[model samples]
Structures are given as structure tokens and as C-alpha cells.
Target chain A: MKDEAMALRDTHVTLAHGGGGQAMRDLIDEVFAAVFQPPGMEDQARLAPGALAEAGARLALTTDAFVVTPLEFPGGDIGKLAVCGTVNDLAVGGARPLWLSAAFIIEEGTEVALLRRLVATMAEEARAAGVRIVTGDTKVVGRGAADGVFITTTGVGVIPAGREVSTGQVRPGDVVIVNGVLGDHGACILAARGDLMLSTDLVSDCAALGHLMEAVLAAAPGVRAARDATRGGIAAVLNEIAGVAGVGIEIDEAAVPLRDEVRGVCEILGLDPLYLANEGRLVLFVPEDEAGAALAAMRTLPEGAGAVVIGRAVAAHPGQVRMRTLFGGSRIVDMLVGEQLPRIC
Target chain B: MKDEAMALRDTHVTLAHGGGGQAMRDLIDEVFAAVFQPPGMEDQARLAPGALAEAGARLALTTDAFVVTPLEFPGGDIGKLAVCGTVNDLAVGGARPLWLSAAFIIEEGTEVALLRRLVATMAEEARAAGVRIVTGDTKVVGRGAADGVFITTTGVGVIPAGREVSTGQVRPGDVVIVNGVLGDHGACILAARGDLMLSTDLVSDCAALGHLMEAVLAAAPGVRAARDATRGGIAAVLNEIAGVAGVGIEIDEAAVPLRDEVRGVCEILGLDPLYLANEGRLVLFVPEDEAGAALAAMRTLPEGAGAVVIGRAVAAHPGQVRMRTLFGGSRIVDMLVGEQLPRIC
Candidate 1:
């Protein structure tokens, strides 16, 4: 906090910081450049040729925009969400996340101290994700023109040789698994809002899963597909896989893992745990023979300590998902039709 | 517009379009994916390994955000600005532009027809730039939470081996040159707003300069520096180069190119043409002996037909910029102190 105060004497963002002059340069130099330490000037980042030539693989590119309300959350902030979101996108595509670019859209009158904290959080998160923020941009709008701040992150990574993970690879007998408990992120955000008149000792499960994903891929080379359960949660991921592969997914409700606090919150709010978002969790499908090894490898990592086999793919009811409830009844799970929680990240 | 109407029954954006479900998929398929024709699904875009391996050089990454007012102008729209902006950043850094990732933050209640036009414009501009729109993300915020729309674009390109362009290469004897007329973009946007009750036939100078930059580099391999005159215009670029190289720059005001329409707007509005924004213009520095060759090469391209030698670097008055007036007077040209035109891109 003291570091932020000394960085910028102004209490709020001003028009000059986005004027593309000395003020803008000072803001970038003091905040972004101080953290990124890019090789050359702040305009464009030039990477070493030798470093890339040795990777020797095609690059995977992905992008996401984060505009979650209440910039700061229980366990993490928008900065962590931006880094982990882009990194996980690359990781799920069978790529090793390497570089990222962050662009900020800030509203005038937003506290400069808040921006400093956010940039610091982003730098820390980038280091944790094993990626460098190569280049970035900042723009400021009038008070009503935008919310406090919105971040758009883009990432690049190298796909290892002969690695192909797609829904097309799924088979009828493929086994489905999840890395950890679901709905922690969404539930935590809801509680943080302080509108539900509820309280719980829940923290967001936001984390960068590149390392854990690498471990799983190493153990289960035959993994058919992998996707993070983000916005529409595990239910949305299953439906997507089913629709693309033209297969049926059957989940055992008893085997799906969830924290008691998350389940309680969902029940009170009339929301289903399956449709809530998760940041640190991923749904993976592999051949039946490789599921055990994949789960064992995932369990070794703290982020995936709750890894479990939740379901299997089938030929019946093609392009559909069905859950066998704990009461021994089956029900269809379809794609969410409308917004549930806006800007929950 | 007719296609947009047929695609979305209601013309305005809805919360469901950003829900990460069927609605989002349909929107992407009908608008973005249909135009981009990305290699794979919207989750991630994978580049062919063989293609990248052949490039055999380091990569350059850059990102920029566009919140320009008046989405549509005489010569270009926000889409063109977003694409050309990032592409120029890479080209100025001596990188062969390749791929781009675009992210959009749309306000709810905005017309889908407007979005379709913007996306189409982006696709066309990307084609002209010889780049691919590989990956993208979209988010929608409630009305009043955001302005109409904002775009953030990130670009990746490979820097050819042995190509070096930086302000550090600048020397006291280097010559300065500009590609074309200045202040056209800023003037055009100002007139487009209609709030000033001003009318003119002027159009924006927005364009992707990858090919033109490549031609200049081929003709003048020993060029010391290059930068697009965007916000803060040529004055900011000169001040930056002076500060970074610890030298002085002296400009001949009579030699600087400017359109009559742009000059008239600046004079009537009490604005300095040197501080107005430009889209397609660039400031390049080279050795005095090679200045003629660079000018000849630039004139070969339509975008640089107005290229001229405008200034020279000096060892005295280090880190300063002074311009010789048409009346034989000289004055310091320091960095822009405060806002001139907001959201000028």
C-alpha cells in the first residue's frame, strides 16, 4: 500500500496519463515497465531468436477479456484471473504457455493506488504462471464511459511435437475426470458481493494450472480432450465435448466433488453447482485404460489434489449429457440459456 | 445490415451472448468465425509447426486498445484503427507481421448490425495487412456500464535475423523523415463528431504500413529508428527519440508535410498541427548519406508519396526538440502537457 502511494501522488487517474505524452510515459515507466522489465522500449517486445528456435514447435494463440465486478475478491483479484485465464486456455490446447500481453481500459477518477496494486498483482501472477508480459497498452475513458478497469490478456505458447488433444479424438469408452472441486470461484464471488446476506469461509479457487496440466499430459499421453470449467462450469464443458464428438456423457452425481460451503451457497441461491464457474478446475477425457494413471499424476499436485473420475462417454443419446442422481434417477443437462452471474470471471 | 437482421431477430446485443453457452457460440459462428475462418474452433487457434519453423527468427509481440469516439468516420472505422494500430507497432520494430488476436468489450443494447459491420471491416483490413485473425474473445456489459464498444488487439510477428531498429542507434548526424501529411486522422475524427459544427472533405489516414515499412527497410538497411505518429503526433515521437538517444532534433517547419484541410482545422480550433494524431504516418531516422535513398524508396509506395526530409539530429541541446518557423524563428517543441483530443486513437 505504501509502495502504491509513493508511485503516484494523484489519488485518481487523470486524462493526461492516456494523452500519449510525458504523463503517459511516466505512468507506464513507473507501473508497467517497472514490473515487466521488457527487453527494449515499451512499444513492442523483441524476444531472442535462439530461445524460440529451440522450442521448435508451432505456436498456440489465445485471448480473453476480464471485467469482473469488485476488482478485489476473497482469494484473488482481476489480475490473477486475467493471467490464469489466458494461461489455462493455452494449456488446455496442449501448448506450453510462454508469453502474454496485457491491455488495460481504465476509467477516469479510478484511484491510482488501486491501479498500482492491480499491476503488482498481475506481475506476481505472471511470474507464478511462468510467462513474461512482453508488451502492453493503457487507455483511459471518462468516469461514466467505463467501469473502474477492464483487462484484456492475450497469450502465446508452443505446442510440443506430435501432441493432439481435441474432441474429435474422444471415443465411446473414454473416461472423464475433473482436477478438483467446482463452484468455489463463483460462490466466493457471490459472497464477496455482500448482497446475498450470506457468509462463508470460502476463497476463490483461481490458479494457473499449466504445471499440473503438464503432469497429467505426461502421464496420460493419450488424453483425448481437456478444457477448463470456467464460465458455465463443468456442465457447459461436457455439453461442448458431447456436441463436438457426437457422443453421450454420463456423470455419476455421487462421484462429482464439491465443497460443503459451495453446495450450501448454491442451495440457498437456487443455483446448481454444475453450472457455476471454476477457475482452477479442468475436465479431462482419456481412454479408460489411462484414467487411473492420469488421476494419480494429477493428485501429486496441490492444485489437483481432489482429482477424481466422474463419468464416461457412451454411444447412446448422442450429443447429450445425462447425470445419474444420487437418488438413482437420470436427468438431462443442457447448455445454459441465459446469464446467471454477470462478470463473475 | 440485412444479414445482421436475419442473424439476430433483435438488433441489439443481449446478456446471453456473453454467457459462454449456445448463444455465444451462435454469435461467434454467425459473425466472427464465419469471417475469420480460423483453422480450428474458437477455443484456441493452432498454427502449423512447419510454417513457423521455416521463419527461423525471433518473434515480436505488441498490444493496443482502441476507444476512439464516433465508431464510423469518413475513411476508416474503429475496426480499421484497431488492426492498423497493432500492425504498425510491429512494423516499426522491424518485425514481419503475422497473426493477431482481437478482443471486444461490447455494451448491452448496442446494435448487432453495427458489430457485424465492424467485424467485417476488421476482416477486410486484416487481409490487406497480410495477417490472420487467429484467435479472439468477446464480452458484453450492461448498458451504462460501458460506452458503445471497445476493442483491444494484440499482434505477433517474427523479427528477421540481423534486423535492428532502435533509438539507441541514433547519432548526431542522422537525418529525420516523415512518410506523409500529419493531423488528418485527428481532424477527421473531430469533424465526424458533429459537436463542433464543423464540416470538411478530409478523411483519416488510417492504413496498415507493413509493406511500406518493409520497402523502406530494404532500401535503407542502416536506418536508426522508426515510429508511427499516433497520439501526441510527431512532436511526441521526436521528444521520445531525443530523450532515449540523449540528443537534440531540429525540424524545418516549411519541410513538414500537411494537408490544407488539416492545417485549417488546427488553426481554427487553436490546436497545434504538430500535436494532432495520425494513423498511417511514420517518423524515420537514417544517416545523412542514406536519406535520399530512403526518401526515393518511400515515394515508390502510394502511402508514402508525400515523404520528405524534415529534420536532422544535433549534439547540442541534448534531449530537446526545436522547430525553425517559416518566418525564420525557432521555438522548443516539448511533449504535450495535457489533453488535446480524447479518444482520438
Candidate 2:
């Protein structure tokens, strides 16, 4: 039964798939139900109580909606992004990702073949993240009412006992480290859109980072906080951390990691890579004494091979972030005043 | 802080609100963060691990997406539907609804005031259902890229100790009971659209059924199975139960509870009340011996004032649903074949 459902695909979807009828049931049975294969046939998925007792002392919940245009992109599609986006959010909050629920809002004329491909990717990613896609819902809108498809994934995880991670824990003399090169996702999506009329071999850095995060936590138990540099890039993350912790952040512009192609695209577009979004990158804060070990641990993973110490926390200029320029000058890095990019995620 | 942020409203939403920038943060603080007020500033909401210990031995998780048009209708809006839709799914599965995560996809140019009104309504409905909106995500797309707004809500709940429910447990001679009048929600949305050129003061029967479901479970703990009549209506639910349990169901048309206005609308439009979607209705399969007490308990609640025995489970014609008409004729009530309604919830 398991392998039999793997090669199946449907060409196009109709409004009936979301009508809560036999057509919908057939669609689910053939596509999602076969893949998920939950324990029972209840409308809701059941998780045994105390299931997380060994993993953590608390539950972490988060959700994200994926509406990235060009559903399929250079390196990954919306499916991989949806899974990794929610999983990364939980991981950055010091949670061991466990279960997820997916809901889809699909246009009536969307090809079922596309949905199958996306679901397959989701299943593969869920397996990589060691989580289950347990429950889901589907709704279909008219042809003109929606884009091709929109996916919203919600995740549940367990926070380890006695391990509290928050921006409030950030203090002076804390080093800031990022997992990998910045802006790969944002840059890749822009180039894929073909609006810039520029071509680059850039691929999105969309991936599940739970395993890498776990490795970092194991080596740097004293890590203060971590955040996925997603929508607003590392600049937004630093500003938010500074604002919430009532501290200031200083980053060396030359020390920040960036791909030459990404740098080129940003330069041509007159956009700052500092504010470009990322899908598989994160910013970590650790006390000065523990920073070395954290960076070493992160560097061991392929996902974090480009890890580097880009900044540090300070008590001066409370609630502010500043960047040291490559020209040996400094300037304030303010929270984005308006939208520099939209639908980049 | 609780009440200080309510007065601000932007004339319209822009790309910045979803850009993960100051504009997005301010909007979240004013609209959602104020209402939810989750503890600590973290990427995910943290919940005590033992919180569900007293409630039951398992957790029930479900998700639903709401794309109902017109945003607002006579009795309820899309916000109310989003909360109630997911909550009722858990409730019908015999779980006490607990926490919810809401994700919103908004089209640029939507009125911020409209979004605020919807968010306020959602908070109110969540409070009424004894659930908290703990985590969320928001995304904005270019104008004409999406409908006005779409919401997908995922819920987590706890099943009570020693309570077990499944369609597999249904048996012959078991009576079926519904909590309230049918099709009000479906009828209301259609009229609200103004496309039918018909309006008769009918409002949607959109309400959280958790409280009412609790009463039913307490009265009939031995109930075989239960299902909420939402997307495909009671007809779809009945057909599913019949097919799953490998049993036949027979319903008396005269016994089904319905409102005159809804019936009039259906009659005028050549629609069957049984096939119209509902928001707060449920069908319970109770043993013949306990059916009377169950119906009585349901009728005591305001949400279930129209409670009545509509049918009985039978062994004949296994895996089929047969309906006895008011004209003394019987016909197979098969699953919905095509899209009768789209974006109804």
C-alpha cells in the first residue's frame, strides 16, 4: 500500500475536490490520505497524551502562510518552503519539531499533477525534519478568485526542559552568528520572476534547519536566542532583537556572508542585500565566552558551512542597530520603513 | 497596553504590512498582538506540557481554510467562520477545544478597518469557544493576486478520559440526532452575495459548537460516533458514516429540523436543505436505548434547541444512505457529485 500510492498522479482538480463529497474523499484518499495514513479515520488527528514527556517540558506552536509567486522556483517550490518555514520557526524557538497540519486553498483550475508534486515534496521534507503531516483541510475557489495555490502550514513542537530561549535573555558582549550566506532565497525568487531581466544561477536556500539547530544547541547550551532571518533578513532580526532586549547591535559589513551572484543582482537592482529575505538562514546570539564553540558547531554542518561571526550585542544606544561599513565608517540600520520587497517568501 | 492600541486603523493595507518590517510589526501590535497578548516575545507560543493532563489521554488536532466571500454577512463573517469551523471539527470528535493558530493571506488594497473588524470578531469568537489564538502569520499579495482575504486556522484540543468515538463503532438500530436547524449558513452566504437577487432576513447559523457538544457527550458517553455538518452538509456526513461503518442509514424527511426561511430559499432555488452547508450543526449516532436522553440534553442548550431524532442506522443496504420522503417515497441519498457551492466556507 505504501509504494503503490507513490506513483499516482491526477491531471487537474475540480471544485468538487473541496466540496466535502466523494470526489473530495477520493482526492484525499488518493493523494493526501495515502501519504499521511493517519492512525484512525477521525476528522481530527490524535496524539497520545504525554507523548512529548521525554522530548521537552512545554509545547511550541506556530503557523505561516506561503504565497510566493512562481510556485515552483529554481531550487525549491512552495511545498518545500512551507514545510521548512514552519519547522524553522519552531526550531529557532528552541523546540524539537514534531507534528504539523497543512491546509490548502487551491484555485479550481489548478492541475492536480502540480498538487501531487508539491505534496510529495512536503512528505519528503517532513521525513527529513522527523515530523508527521497528520491533519489537513482543502478548499477550492473559482478560477479567477485565487492564484494557482496557497499553502498554510501550522507546526507543533516540544521545548526541552529548563531551556528557556528568548530575546530578553540577550545581554551585552553577546556575539551574533548567522548560519549561512544571506539573501539567497530573496535573490533567487527575484531572478526567477524574470522582471529584473537578469539571469543568475542562484538557488533558494529553502531547507529544514531543525537538525542543524539541534547541533548548535548541543554545543552551545548557553546560547541566548535564535531567530530565522526570513522575511526581513538579518537586519530586521537584529533590529527586533535590539528593540525587545533594550540593547544595541553592531555588525561588521565585510564580515557578513553573501554569494557574489547575489551581490551582483542586488547591486544591479540598487537593493541592499542586508534587507533581502532568506528561507534557510538564522541569526544566533550567544555570550562572548560561548560564541567560539557555537560557531564551530554550526560550521560542521553543510547547511551552516558559511557560518560566521558578523556582529555583537552592546548596551549603548539602547534599542538600536548599527553596521560598520566596508569603508571603515558606521551607519544606523533601522527597521524597514516601507516594503522593499513583497511576496518574496 | 491592552486597550491603548485599539483606536489606530490604516485606510488600506500595503505590501509593507507583510514585509516583516516596522509597518508589519506596528500592524501586528495594533491589531493581533494586542488581542492575543501571548506571553513573552518568541517566534512560537510556549505552552506548559502538563496543561492537557487533566483534560484527557490524547490530543485532537484539526485545520480548516475559510474563503467565504463578501467578508461579512448577516449573522457571521469569514473571521467567525474560520474560528468556528476548526473548533467545531475538534468538538464533534469529542475533544475540548484549547488552542488555535491563525494564518491570514490578504490582498493589497484591502481596508485595514475591515481586517481589524474581522480580527476583533475572531477574538470574540475564540473567547466564546474557550480557546486562545496563540500564534499567527500574515502575508500580503499584489492587488488582484488574491481575493479580499483568506484565513486558515489550526486547532489543538484534548479528549476527555475514557471517552472514545469513531464511525467504526456505529451499529444497527442506533438513532441519529442533529443539534439544530440545517442550512442557515449556506442559505445566508448565498443571499449575502446578492447574486440571487433574494434577501429574506436569513442569517448564518455560524457558532462554535464546543459547549453544545460537551453537553451531548456528557449525556450520551456511549454514543457510537459523531460528525459536524459543515462543508458538504449533513448529507455528505451521513454518506461518509454509512460507507465507513459498512451500514445503511434511513432518515425521515419530515423529522429533519429546519427553519422556514431556509426552506423557502432552498425551495425557490431548487436546492435541498439536506445538502446545504451548516456551521453549528452535528449528527450523532446513539444507541436506541440512550437516544431519548441524548436528544433531551441537546434540546436544553440554546444552540441545540431544534434537536431531534432524524434517522436510524440499519443493517440493510449496507454502505448506503436512504431517505424517506415526505411524499411516502424513498431514494438513495448519494454523496454530492459536483460543486453545488464554492467558497461557502
Candidate 3:
């Protein structure tokens, strides 16, 4: 089997590999099935009851499509981003991710080596996050129909009993905290593209936050809600939370952490770091009394090492976000109206 | 909200619609969120326990990516096909599909009106199939990066206690049954593409088979296994079952049902009807004694009006499929080798 897979790896993927024939079977068996090692050859994965068996435990389901350019980037590739993105979506909702279903839409003539690398990265990330890639499907389209490859990962998790998290749960007195510095991933992608002729060594802040979130939940039980500051970055998340909760959010610009290189990239591009995407960063809304506990717990994990309070919910100016600059000026941070950066994920 | 959604339907999809900001939110809200009406605004859908709570019940998870060209054809569109495809995958495994997550990768510059039509069809189909579109995500790529729109749907179902279905469970004496006439989907797509200058009113045989499968399972409890005759059609399915169970399959060519138009299309294109895809078809392996019951149960549904017995498992020539021709000659029916029809699903 290994020999067969190795032989197939020397060629680019063809449409026959997705035609539901012997070639397709060989591709699936030798490439994906060998690594995933799903338990049965059934159309669906039969998963035994776990946290879902507990009383009052609810199922958490989410899906995301990854279409990042330059499939391979500095710190991570699209595979790592796909896994981390889905895992974090579940984690921030206080759900323990258990299984993921990854579907690939590959453009014909794509190198098999690229697929192997992406699959390997996915398997490694899944192992690290303690989840299983149990079921998947692949479709191949003609050249120019798709960009190299696109992955859509759907995650399944279980929210333990008594664990309720939502933007609506955020209250006026809640304290807003972020796990780490902002915009590393956005800046990294910009430099990686090399379109602007700017060079930087910044890597994507892409990492699974399930473990870090679990730790924070244990330490700060009073945490109202948590959200990953991803595509729209911290600004989008803040605006969404404030709009949903019908409250105002106020942040101190000086309190927000940022790396010098990331800040420089944003300044050069005339973009605000607050709206730049981040893969590993998240915002936590905790009760004022438990804010310290959340910060302390977050600081212990490498993914959350730079945890700090950047803002708080307020009763003034309901359904809006404001930031106070170091020069004592205040400005409203509204939801982005148009495209700032495309396919930043 | 309806006015806002109506106003946005005039323009084409832009990068801003996928930027995770206000424009993205508006597109999601007016186009998708309004129709799907997912339970909450959280990143994940929190689903209350249902059939999963039963003792010995197992969770069923499956994913599929649909990149059908032309987006729409007679009888159904991509949205309708996406829902039925995932639902049928679960149903054939003796699982009750309960929820689905849909993720879309749309190319920039695609018309928003087309999106609305797709979403509307999805909502209608989900209602008819008795499943919920609980959570989803969307990403947009630049023009030409994608064909038009690609949808990946992940389904969650519950396999009730004591139910099991797998290709490996087929026995030598099992009887084979299919729900309906084959090749309509493939023929319809060929006509829709208009590349061969063929014209036909044959519509795609795309429909949700969950209810039909449930009825058959109830009536024929001795059914061994079942598989949907999709991509590579019945030929691929038979090959897979034979290879897995190490049993030979012999089908009666005279007994297999095919529409005249579909057969004409195949003849013109020099294609074998057996190798053409079907969106609403399945082959079931049942104990010889229960074959009548299974056929009776299947015929009770509109989707299975043409139910018939076309094959049986045999001990001779293990791991091979043979067909008894109308001329009384037997021929090896091997798996498809290359692309017969791309993006048929």
C-alpha cells in the first residue's frame, strides 16, 4: 500500500481521481484513507457517545471555508489554518471539539505533493487538538475552475452542561480581554504575498486555542462569552458583541498589545491593525471580578501569553464601540463597511 | 430586514461581502441568515440532544463537496442537490439525518440574484427533508479563481440502536435492488451543457431519499447493506461492494430499468448507461427472502416507483461483478477507469 501511494505521489491529480472509479479509489485509499484510517468503509462515520451522553450537554456545529492565497505561508499553511479556524470556532463557544469532517475541492493538475503536505499538517493539528478527522469527500474540477485547492472543514463539539456562552450574554459591566497581540497573521500574509515589495519575518499567529480556552474556562467560570478575532479581526468581533448585547464597548488604545513589525506593516499599508485578521487571537468577556483570573490563566499558555484587558462593556452609546487614543482623543470603531484585505484567512 | 435584503440583490457579489465586516454581515443576514434562521449568532450552533440520547445510538457524520457546473439544470439546482446528496449519504447508512452545516466558496462578481435563488432552494429542501441548516460560513474568491459557487455540506445523523449497514456485510446469497431508473442525472447534465448538441427533456433524478430509506428499513429488517449509485453510477457501487465483501455479483441486464431518452443519450455519446451517474438511486443488498418486502416498501414512494431486482451476490469469481446480457452472454462489468462525466453531482 505504501509503495502504491508513493508511486501515485509522483504525478499531479487528474479528474479520474474524482470520478468514483478505480483511480478515485486508489487515490482515496493510498492518499487519504491511509492517513485518516477511518474505522469503517461506510458512507458515514459511526461515533460512539461521549460528552453528548451527559445530561444537558448540547452539540456544537460549525463550518468554515479556507481559500487563502499562497496555500503555503510563513508560519503555517492552509491546512493548519483550516483546522485551527474550525477548532477555535467551537472552543470559543465553550464546546470541546471532538470530530471534524474535511472536504476538499481540488483543481485538476494540482501537485500530489502539495496535497500530502496539507493532509499531513491537518492530521498533526487534529492530533494536537485531540480531535478526529473521521469523514471527508473530495471533488476535482477542471483547471482554472478552482484556485489550486480549497478546503471546507466542518467541526462537531459538545458543550458541557451549564456552560453557556454567547455575545448576548455579555453585560454592560463585563470586562473585555484578548489572548494575545493583534494582526500578526494579516501582516504575515501581506509580506508573504510580496506584492507590496515589503519584507518581514513575521509568522502567522495560527494555533489551536482549544487547550488554552479550556484552561481559562476552568479558572474563570464567570466568563460571559468568548469570540475568536478572526476575519474581521478584533474590530469586527467587538462590533458584533456590542450590537448583539445592546451595549457600548470602550477600549484604551495604549492597552492593546502589538508587535513592532506588525504595526509597521499596517502603517505602511495605511491599514488599522485592529481590523487585520488573526488566527489565534480571541476576545473574552468576563465579569469584572473574574477578569484577573481570566488574565492569569491565559498568561500561562503560550497561545495566550500576551493576554491583556483592551476594553470593557459600557451602558453609554448602546450598540457601538469606541477607542480612546493615547493623545486623549476618542473615536468610534464601527464595523468595517467594505473589503480591507481579501481572503486573509 | 427584507427591504435591506431586497436592495442588495441588484448587484454582484464583491470581496467586501466575504471580508467579515458590515458588508459580509449584510449579505449573510439578508441572503442566508434570514432564510436559514439559525438559532443564534454564535460561531457554533448549539443543538439540543435528540435521538442521540437513546441508549446505544451512535452519531453519524459525513461531508461532501459539490462543484456541479452550470449551477442549475432541469428538476433541480446545486442547492437542492447539495441537501439531497448529504441527506442520502446518511440515510443509506441507516442513520436519521438531523442537522447539516453548509459552507460556500463563491467567486467574486457572481450575481447576488443567483445566490438568493440557491439559498431559497436550500431552505425549501431542508424543510421537506426534515433537517436544519444550523450553521454555515461563506468565502469569496476573485473572479476566475472559482467557476461560480461551490458548496460543501457536512451532515450529522443518529444511527438508532441495533442498526448497522456496511458494504462488507454483503453475503453471497443477498439480492440486489435499486430504487429507480438510472442515468437521467448524467444525461440531463449532458443536455444542459449543450456541448454535444443533444436535446432532451430528461430531468436530473435528484431527490431526498431519507424517507424512502426509512420506510424500506422498517419493512425489510433483514437488509444487509445499501449504497447510493452516484458518481461512477451502479457499476462503481457494485465493484466496491464486491471488492469489499469478496463476493461475486451477477446482474440481469434485461431487468435493469432505463429511460429511453437516457439510453439514447448514452448511445449517441458512446457511453455505457450503467456507468452514468444518478442523483436519486441506490442499490440495496437484502436477504433473498426479504427482497419482495424491500421492493414493495420502496415502490410506495414516488422516488422509488421503478424499484426492481437487477442483481444477486454469488460465490463464483470472488471480488468481481458480471452482467448477464440480453443476448444470454455474460460479460465482466468492471469499475470505471477514467472521467466519464465530470461534476455530474
Each candidate structure's TM-score, on Cα atoms with residue i matched to residue i, is 0.96, 0.96, 0.98
**Residue by residue across B5-78, what tens digits does model 1's lDDT show?**
43546578898878777667777778788888888763888886333354546688999999999999999999
Which candidate do you rate higher for lDDT, 2 or 3?
Answer: 3
Across A232-343, the per-residue lDDT of candidate 3 in tens digits comes to 8999999999988999999999999999999999888899999999999999999999999989999998998999999899999988899999999999898887888998
The per-residue C-alpha lDDT of model 1 at residue B214 equals: 94
Where model 1 places Cα greater than 4 Å from the true spot, the runs are: A1-7, A49-56, B1-7, B49-56
Report how far residue A237 has shifted in candidate 1, in Å. 1.2
lDDT score of residue B83 within candidate 3: 95
Residue A237 miss distance in model 2 (angstroms): 0.6
Give the range of the ten consecutive residues with the poorest summed lDDT in model 3 chain A. A1-10
lDDT tens string, model 2, A160-188? 78787788889989999998899999999
DockQ of each: 0.56, 0.65, 0.75
Deviating ranges (above 4 Å) for candidate 2: A1-10, A54-56, B1-9, B54-56
* Chain B structural similarity as TM-score, candidate 1: 0.96
Write the residue-wise lDDT of candidate 2 on B167-205 in tens digits.
Answer: 888998999999888999999988989999996788888
Question: What DockQ would candidate 3 receive versus the native complex?
Answer: 0.75
